[model samples]
Target chain A: MTGVVSPMAAPAALRGAGAWKPAELLFWTLPVIGWFAFPENLPLLTQIAITALFALSLDLVLGVAGMVTLGHAAFFGVGAYAAGMLPAYLGIGDPLLGLVAAAAAAALAGALTSPLMLRGSGLSQLMVSVGINAMLYEAANKATEVTGGVDGLPGVENTPLFGMWSFDLYGRTAYVYAVVVLLLLFWMARRVVRSPFGVSLRGIRLNAARMPALGVPVNRRLAVVWTLAAAYAGVAGALLTQTTQFVSINVLGFDRSAEVLLILILGGAGHLYGALVGAVAYMSIHHLLADIDPEFWQFWIGLIFIVVVLFARDGALGAAARIRDLIRNLILGRGASR
Target chain B: MTILFDGIASGMLLFLISSGLSVTLGLMGIINLAHGAFAMLGGYVCVVALDRYGIPFPVAVLMATLSAAAAGVALERLVYRRLYGAGQLDQVLFSIGLIFVSMALARWLFGPQPQPIRLPGWLQGQVQLPWIEIGVYRAFLIVLGLVVAVTLHRAVGVTRFGARLRAAVDRPAVARGLGIDVDRVFVVAFAIGSALAGLGGAVGVELLGLDPSFPLRYLVYFLIVVVVGGSGSFEGSLVASVLIGIFDVAGKYYVPQVGSFIIYTVMVVMLIVRPQGLFGRPSP
Candidate 1:
């Protein structure tokens, strides 16, 4: 609690490196460059983009707002179901409308559940979050008429980008669509984290008890941010459903929540870009390792998780910044060149 | 009436399974997710000893518990010792990693499905009561659960170790000045807790359904028992488990469609009603 970097310490390295600045030109253009470089891996890249967005939403609560949620997948699953249902059952393939409905649905779920989270501490909170997620999973599983249950909701057809470009098998449109959505959400998140309200969320995260004395309405702020984050996560889930054209019960599983949380931590939470970088690195490494031995990959991933928590204080992004700072200080002298 | 009996029987096992975790969680503030893994290990150990080596069931339970206790001691010395002062999340992550390692090892060694075990004749049949009937194994479980819970409660609530732990937790410097072996107490308590978990796992395997994924599957249930019952309170955990056990059992029997909902509802309602748990210690 004392020495460990609080999840809210915005990593200056990633903020500088990930932002769309002239020096960090690659941050904005990487997807475009990646589109050209890894032509065959568009589908994987699209998945990475969607997962990155989901992790980003978690950072708002876990990092910026200091809520340790194990049930964040509830929003994602809700979004996926809501979005997929439109095209599958309602015959409405309008991607934008589906995305809105998904976000709205998830936001409502978050608003309702956020109050339940506010009552407990540590283990109680952890159990509640897990409990809520499990409840949602059960709800989704039982609501077979809508969710299609174990078989998963099928027949989701995308209406194309603004009614122009349809989703293609080569994943060209899907990749572009996912990237655009991620960038928009990433920019919006950046705005939210830098605003006055975001700073209040930070104050609450650092010390919620003291914040109310300073006149910050802690519960309201937390609920608001939580709802917003849920909306963002829902959109990400919708993006996945829209591009992949499928939604499964696995979306609501504990594994999905855990993996996204791990990805956020791996990227070094707090910073907006931590999610994106963490998602890319984790997914890629997982992809590589999983391919090597499908049966035993969880062992390696678990090992990675342990090693990351033990050795890497801030995760890969956090560690990378420290290394960069060390090199800069050695070359330019401490506090000399900046 | 039968449902009530079954609920009480199941509740007893829940108490046994969670008491160790509840103690360690409150006293040490260590979020050891691997707690269930130790329970799973105990089950597998009991199964192996009973099936392959032809050990009697009761003896095998003792062996399984001791083995798990030994593992806990080794783990405490080797890994957990370094982590005593670490962040709470770090502890959770570390223990989770350990559980995953154990799970993989179990799969590699024992293969995928739940290890098979056959109950002996005396422990297999049901005994009819005035209004209801209960399995002999369930009766054994209730006895085992009561004995362990009472022993633990007495040991932690009335014994010298309890006083020493309280002193240490309250005023470490003063306790140390008084020559209390705080470290030894911690080690002993941790070992006992692990043994209890192992014993519970071994005994409850048939009821809870053990397999390689045992830890992950039953983690929520264990946590619910500890947190909902209120950490650091033996009485609290006992009460919570009985209530939960009855609700869960009765839910499945009566409202087959919404069984999980019943449990989740209890957890949510409990948290709202008592955020610190029914008898949880006020946060330090």
Candidate 2:
């Protein structure tokens, strides 16, 4: 909580506080480029987008708000179930409607659980989050008739995007749809994290006890951010369900929660773009490693985690920054000597 | 009647497995999520010895315990020693990483299937008690668990090593000033905790099942024991483990559909009511 480097050191435009820079614009365009450049890999690209969004949501909680959680998948699963159930049970297949329902359901869950999270110390908070997740997983597992149990909810057919672009086999439509949602949500998140409210969140994260003395409603702010993060995660989950037309209990699994947290950390926490970078790196590595040996990929991932924690500490981005500083210092020192 | 007996028996097994975790978390302030991996390792060792090498059950259990302790010592010296002053997040991530590595290693060694073990004839079959018959293995587990518990209690309460350990944990600087090797005490405590986990794994294999996913599967239960018992409180873990075991068994028996939902709900409620846990000191 104390050592989280703020995103202020990022280049001004990348901080998302001013007019968009060409690099910022180009970053979003890469997904669009991938849509055309790698048509066959659209499915994987789409998954990467969804996972990035999920990681972004986690960053808001763990990175910005400084809350450590292992149960964020509870919100993701809630959103997924909401979206999936809408089409299967209620015959509402509108993608936009599904997104809304998912967000609301997930946000509601966050609101309900935030009190518990707010009451405990870091260790207790971790335990409470985990406990909540286990309860939800068990509940979902037991509600076979409604959730389709372990077999996963079937017959989730969504209406065409805007009643025009039908999802095709090659996943072109799903890919575009997912990227668009990610862009919109990412844009909103960027704004929120740069706002005064966002600044206050950093303050609370740094020193919660002193924030209340400054007249900041510490618990209320945390509750709001936690809910907002849940909504973002819910949207990610909704996109997953819409693209795949499947909702399995695995969405709520502990692995998903752990995976997303790792993704955020691997990219670098507290930096908005780090989530995006981390997700892409993680999924790509996962894809390549799994191809080489499906079962042993975890071993490599574990090794990476250990190395990262021991050396990089701040993740991939942090390591890059350190190398950059080292080169710059070396050049400056040589110039001064000369 | 049978349900109660079964609940207590299973509870005893739970205490054995989680007692190690409680010790580490309470005394060392390390959230060792990989504790279950050590348990799994012991179970695998015991299984391979008894099934493949034709080793006797008792000797296999002893070997399992020793191996796990050795692994614990190695990890402590190599990895955990550096993480003592790190944040909870780093410790958590590190242990989780260890879990993944151990899991993959287990899959490679054991082929992703639940390991099978053959209990000796003496430990097999039902034992007649005056009113009810109980599985001999379960009865043995209860006796073993109690013996370990009492011995551990006395060791921590009466022995000079225990006094040094308590001194080191409560006031590290003062203990070091008093010529106590705090680091050595921690290493010993960690090994002892891991040995207990191994012992639990060897004996509880038939009941809990052994597989690559064993660590992740039983992680929550161990965590529950540590958290609810309050970190650093030995008796608290015992009480919490027994309560959770009974609840888990009764829930599965009476409401098979709900399964573990009941216990999870209870845990959540307990946490909400007492975030510091049943016997823990209030957070600073």
**CAPRI tier of model 1:** medium
Query: Which tens-of-lDDT digit does each residue in B43-153 have in candidate 2?
Result: 999999999999999999999999999999999999888888888888888888898999999999889989888999999999788999998888898888788878887
* Candidate with maximal DockQ: 2
- Candidate 1, residue B62: the lDDT equals 92
State the displacement of the C-alpha of residue A191, model 2, in Å, after optimal TM-score superposition.
1.3
How well does chain A score by TM in each candidate? 0.88, 0.89
Scored by TM against the true chain B, the candidates give: 0.96, 0.97
lDDT of 1 by residue, B1-284 (tens): 87887898899999998888876776666787788988988999999888898899999899989988988888887777667778666676677777777877788788788777776677899888886777899889888888988898898889988888778766767999999986776777778779888999999878998788988878778888888878778888888888889999999999887757778778888888888888887676
User: Compared with the true structure, what per-residue lDDT tens digits does model 2 show for residues A111-215?
Assistant: 999998888867888989888988899899999999988999988999999999988999999998998899989888877777666777988989988988867
